[model samples]
Target: MKKISQKNDKMTTVSLTQILENGIWQMEAEFSNSQYYAAIGIVRDTYNIPADTHPGLDPHCHHMVSYGMSGYQWGDGAVNYKGNRTEGNIAYKDNQIIKAEYDSEKGTVIFSVDGVQQPVYVRGINEKVRFIIYMCYSQASCTIRSLKKLIAPTTKHVANEIAVQW
Candidate 1:
């Protein structure tokens, strides 16, 4: 497994090499000893954001979705965009698993803590995107547990009909 570390005083952002366009993709991450915030989300593959910049804070990249410490979710250059909030004001704890799932077909991205899905989600994303993470303080580190494409569930569409009286 490859590890990325930031031992400096400046904030840093990192992205995965895989590009996700269609179908559902999920990434699970665990943060340790982080200060300020450790953020995880997805960004457009074509965006040219600086390594020291936070993708959620970039006005040019408004489709990004990120969840960080203190139950904060940032997307479309706005904090808690659309009033989405985490349950119980959760904060980043050691070895706490945070999962981010993106469904391209639905043009939405949602985050979950451990296994419970959060209430907030971002929508209207139509571009190919890559998974990204941000570290805001020195000695902060993250472990990407898994990144994989999920099998799309097959469902049959059924039409509802109402009986009409003559």
Candidate 2:
């Protein structure tokens, strides 16, 4: 692991593997002062990246975005931004996503996410559904964990997602 800073020297690395406990992959991010915090994003046909050359399909596609959360002007935090039709071609805005696709028979919810253009074989996400995927520029600093361990999982008030598991 690499040290995050010269001041405190916190080791840092984002896990590619889902940290599933009961049966899901849940992420929660919060804010403090919000100059910019550590963040990761998957590139796709969106974000001005060309479709054919889009990193959404590439396993090595990881980018960085930013946000300022001091005053919560953007409601700045981990966002799963979605665009509306009247907002022109791109409708989704920046948001924090807490979505899940569960298996009724197997009794397991989706523990992974579809990279930008990568085909997801989730139980419900069919190929026809459209999702606007984007990157995190800058964001607040907060501990994010699976909901099984959440003391208080954020709701739609400050967070945004497609579906809620609970």
Candidate 3:
């Protein structure tokens, strides 16, 4: 794990992680503010570290899912990067845990707000997906509270020769 920070402590921050195949990935972020914006992104590659208050992913191609005072959307590259609202819902808001859990075995990613699953953004994301947490526009901020990656459980075949006890 690397110690990454936002370019400006008062405005915005970007935290990125490499998604490993055959593993389960989970990231939790704490957000506050009603006028500013907080969002999450999954990129095919790493974003330029130490993002400023500019409020968008630079030098990286990503699929973004934003949830907060700014509303919700699924976009490519940045927050409201397209200037258009897509089909999505505002999953959560101030002082809540926005979580992302990835299952490599199923090639699926799940987003939840305060432990309640929202919806699966999309399937078949790259095995090496880049996870990003960002907040921009206005004086709001977001913190990457926790990030963990665990090996997916494996199933073992049992032989019928083993006696069964009821």
Position 145, candidate 1: lDDT: 87
Q: Each model's C-alpha lDDT?
A: 0.64, 0.25, 0.50
Tell me the tens digit of each residue's lDDT in model 3 across 125-154.
554665666654454556678778866522
lDDT of 1 by residue, 94-122 (tens): 57887777778877776667776655556
- lDDT for position 58 in model 1: 45
Candidate 3 is scored at a TM of 0.61
In terms of TM-score, the best-performing candidate is: 1
**Better by TM-score, candidate 3 or 2:** 3
lDDT of 2 by residue, 1-166 (tens): 1111212222122332333333223333322222332333221222344322212223223321111122222333322222110111111122332233223333222222221211121232211111122222233233332323333322222122233111
Assess candidate 1 and give its TM-score to the true structure: 0.76
Clashes of each: 0, 17, 0
Q: Please give each candidate's TM-score.
A: 0.76, 0.26, 0.61
Among all windows of ten consecutive residues in candidate 1, which has the lowest summed lDDT? 157-166
Error of 2 at 161 (Å): 10
Residue 150 error for model 2, in Å?
11
